[model samples]
Target: MLAHNQDSLKRTPLYSLHVSLGGKMVPFAGYDMPVQYPAGVLKEHLHARAAAGLFDVSHMGQIALRPKSGKLADAARALERLVPQDIVAIAEGRQRYAQFTNADGGILDDLMVANFGDHLFLVVNAACKDADEAHLRANLSGECIIEQLADRALIALQGPKAEAVLGKLCAEAPAMKFMDAGPHEIAGIKCFVSRSGYTGEDGFEISVPAGDAERLARMLLDNPDVLPIGLGARDSLRLEAGLCLYGHDIDTATTPVEAALEWSVQKSRRSGGARAGGFPGAETILAHFDGGASRRRVGLRAEGRAPVREGALLFADSAGGEPIGKVTSGGFGPSLSAPVAMGYVPTNLSALGTKLFAEVRGQRLAVQVAAMPFVKNTYKR
Candidate 1:
């Protein structure tokens, strides 16, 4: 979805509103996106932790995989063939996170899959949408129909007060548990909402009609607790939550085992289970469950306030030993009031409390392996 030569960058439904609110826009995933608002990234990060923050994620691709018949399992089964996830076991009104892996057990893209009444809904990264759609068309049987809901827009309302704020507009929003999704009529607009998001907070991601999106967003902003947030805070929030940002934290060269995403591939997808080995790269991925990966991702905490930026090489000691790994995502965690980061290191050096040094600004900065979610995940499950 990159805007190559002769193609201009795309704009989201909320572009004008972002500009009106003093948002600083930047190009991201082929779209003109807001990096921060008038309040800045620091305040926006803290606001999402203490109150509710609304984010426009309409650039993401919303897809519907509908089987010819009403049996949802048929659609789920077809999807299971491509991903190493127990999609068949996903109950109605529930959602799960999954990745599309290439033949070598490398991630093609990470996406969110939700089970609606009679179909499966997938929210894929904007940059990989076209390729992902092509992959689906090539792999899924004809009986499974793939449709991209281009007329819809995705909005994320997150934080502790998110439920209460959204509840006032949609009565059922507050009652939903984490990863729950269902039909709802919000402020007179028919939409599908899921009690999920990337901020590691109790929140919801609402898929509303493109035409009604701006109205709904404005209405949500009317709430005292909701502030219009942008991509800057979104990245910092997810980074502090220990969540991976597709291209940075996980890419084509990284495997699930090495990325610390083993739990995503449930036991049913592994060897000795009822259904196993159907997904792409199953041999290599499943084998990793037993033999373990040579390098594993780990959470890191810098000793001081200076944030360790991505691509910083890691060393074993002050003597500048051979580089052990590289920082993938790193930033100042507002909630934690410290510099937090994640990186891949050798298995022996990835254990909690293990010491490592990041080459920051030509100096080796001391860092320690620490538990992730620099700020505890407050998901209301």
Candidate 2:
């Protein structure tokens, strides 16, 4: 996360509420965000997995794309020009994950694209929001209306009990399947809700007017099954879920294929498909789809209790030879009660059960390549 001076840091709508709840504030993405609460990161992580965790993600960017030609397909097609995803195929009231790619096949930023009938809604990383808006305006202003929803506050209600807690306020919560997104009324507040979140649990992300954010958050916290979560636990949860953090797990230098995100690129955007090779870096990215990338992102399991953090160099063996790869994200997974991490390694060494060594504190710690999502996902399909 990007850090800025405390004086220049922005505050989310829930800042006061977080302070009232005794949250430990820290600079994140140029905003003063809570890193943890009184209950601490460990408890918060486990609570979310067992119950529900409400997260203040107002820092994320929300944008709306309306077609000038009065057709949603026009907007989708225009978006397809920038991202490799099949936006045109996204059904109404459904959303899909996508990435903005550079001409050299590097990812500019990752985002969510939701089809809302006449328009498309996008949620992008907070640190990349400004640049992402500029990118859209530069490439899609003519074919679509690019409006940033700066007045909205995004709240994520994640975990297994998310539905039970949110259903008390919105009846439609029970009917919404994973990735289903649309407008809904919660506690008499008009909001846009999506059954998706960073955690590998069934949940909902609600976008509400900034003014009513505190009230909505307070109401959600009123439920016994829900607890307020902060950024610390959020990171560990996503890491355990095998999800990528924008700058750490992915960035401008990482291609989707190299990051093991080829699944986000739909078949329509692949070679010989209907809309193939129109996006930026289509040649390079698509080539990787056919020939494969030199390295692939894979999960890593440390043999001991010590966590191998980001930037830790990976070696082929404990004896110390040439560095084979590097750890990108790592921490103690609360769900697993052990250290889990994700890193990039040569395809030959990325297979499950492949043994590797990570240099931590000048000591070569044994690590094994493992399958991702160390914790099983409980999405309600």
lDDT of each: 0.91, 0.95
Q: Could you tell me the TM-score of candidate 1? A: 0.97
lDDT per residue, candidate 1, 206-300, as tens digits?
99999999999999999989998999999999998999999999988888999999989888888998898798888889888889888998999
The RMSD (Cα, Å) of candidate 1 is 1.9
Q: Worst 10-residue stretch by lDDT in candidate 2?
A: 1-10
Tell me the tens digit of each residue's lDDT in model 2 across 164-188: 8999999999999999999999999
Model 2 CA RMSD to the hidden true structure, in angstroms? 1.7
Estimate the overall C-alpha local distance difference test score of candidate 2.
0.95
**Lowest summed lDDT window (length 10), candidate 1:** 1-10
Task: Compare the candidates by TM-score and give the number of the best one.
Answer: 2
For residue 22, what is the lDDT in candidate 2?
98
